[model samples]
Target: MKLARRLQAIKPSATLALNARAKALAASGKDVVVLAAGEPDFDTPEFVKQAAIEALRTGFTKYTATAGMPELREAVCRKLEKDNGLKYAPEQVVVTAGGKQSLYNCFQALLDEGDEVIIFAPYWVSYPDMVHLAGGTPVIVPTREEDGYAPDPAAIKKALTPRTRAIILNSPANPTGAVYSRATLEGIADAVRGHDCFIVTDDMYEKLLYTGEPFLNLGNVAPDLVPRLLVSNGLSKSYAMTGWRLGYAAGPKALISGMQLVQDQSTSNASSITQKAALAALNGPTDTITAMVNEYRERRDLFVAGLNAIPGIRCRLPEGAFYAMADVRGLLGKTYKGKPLTDSLQLSEALLNDFLVAAVPGDPFGAPGYIRMSFVTSREVLQKGLTRLRDFVAALG
Candidate 1:
């Protein structure tokens, strides 16, 4: 059976695949220490869950507007205004299945065939594939690990071309938790000044910041870019509502309408009950998120320290999010058992199969010499994973 040609250009999410493999091994009683998760281990706040329960009791199970529940869209607006210092009307917002969908809709709405989207290295795995699926090419600009994986403004300018349609920025980024600072954002704003490309900001991990500084996106530092910025965020990471399938984006009314149209023909409204729960999440107290961030900070310090202590691994203390992108380049050229540890993929496989530890390789993230480990699990689990990783490195010859 012939499949869509688009499938040829993409692969399944590396993190999800590793996570599933780990779960399967655990199901088989292998005692696999799964550390590839992108979601928080914390359960959804009870108040948010109660909101969904109430919605079910009140028979709010029907389909909502193709865009989303009007109230929920309004709540999204409130979130943007209060949190991001960016104001938007409900007409300028569209809620989709997840932040991923919100971004997919943006690309589908904005990109023409042969268009290009600038993405930084150590980026979210889905960005390039999503761009490919939308008939847009992904222009990867590699960031230095020493720079905290922050995108360089001059490098971005050098990558832009007549075909460049948009630039995607994920602050408190995935895989690598590099939060773009206000200065960094302003530099990017300066670099893209003459360009006609839109800036897509995925703020999925905005609430998971470990930095002592405040969260800032390109929109916040450069209000002029707000018109062209598509701010995508969701309840998944911040509110621990991964299964809720509710995410939203706000931009120009026309772009929002175009994204809404794209969504209308696809998975229409994000789940109806999830919309209610999202409403509660957006308007509810953020104490739960604060608690989660605090716990993640402790785990981050511990796990990163553990990785750095290993003979050949060096890990940076991430500024935000829950991942540690460890440079295993020093460990390369060695053999695990008899197999050569050639790259991150091979290293990841060796760790998972031989050491019963699962971590996402950085090769899929455009960083071949590194591996990404999530500190999203409990401290005990993190310690166990670290122990296994140490033993794996020690066994490599």
Candidate 2:
């Protein structure tokens, strides 16, 4: 049997892999506390569910237009206008199965073989893999926890080249929870002006922010750049509709059309029923979103504070999303049960095996000496996980 060389350049998602391992451990009767999930723990709002039920009842379970249902795209446009202050028409939007597919579509639509995609380190686990699978080179630029994991505009500018096709931005990011400041976003927007590279902004966590400020979008900051920016968002995190699998991207008509063509050749349209549900999520009440954000703020404050109080674990205060990247660098060069605990991967294994806790190692996220813990669970479970984490770190010598 022959395997494609592309497979050699990619690894399975560390978050999903660890989640499966945790579920398996729990099924075996182990007291496994899994903290690797990236979705909100909240249930989908009743209104959204009701809308989907009605869609099914009305025989709306068939395929939609390749770009999306017209109304759904209109709803997405309204969301951008009302929420992010960015304007778009339905023709400039492409509804994807999830935000992931929008990104995949962008990679496929724009990237040629050996073209470069700029990605910030400690990024979403899937970005580089998506680039590689699309035959684009992923050029990773390092960022520091001290800087809140925000990509520097100067560094991004430095990474740009003739072959650079796009720069991926994820604010209120996955696994890190670092939201880009408005100034930073503006700087990025200003720097990339007139450049051929597109700014691919992933706003999956836009509504999940703990910050009091409104969601900062590059397109909103520099509307002139909107034609070159792709703002990809979905109802997964914000609306607690991960399984609903409806994501949409708004950008230039040409790019959106290209992404739609890629989607057309592949999955065609997103689920028609899910598209209806997403329409309700965007156009219906946002009170559910507010409630979820409030709960996540409480959990994040409790969990990050608890982690920072631990002897060797230090977690920065995350600005948004539901994750905390715990810096276990202080725990390295130490020993656990006569074996050297040297890297983030080894420490994550000890946490999973010996401590009966599951966490994704930061190595896969391009930030080793740390591990990511998601607070997308009950406060009780989070507290228990933190206690176990403390005990495990204390056992290290």
Q: Name the candidate that leads on TM-score.
A: 1
Which segments of model 2 are wrong by more than 4 Å? none
| Model 2 residue 179 CA deviation in Å | 1.3
Instruction: Report the backbone clash tally of model 1.
Output: 0
What are the per-model numbers of colliding residue pairs? 0, 0
Task: Check candidate 1 and list the clashing pairs.
Answer: none
TM-score of each: 0.98, 0.98
**lDDT, model 1:** 0.90
Candidate-wise lDDT, in order = 0.90, 0.90
| TM-score of model number 1 | 0.98
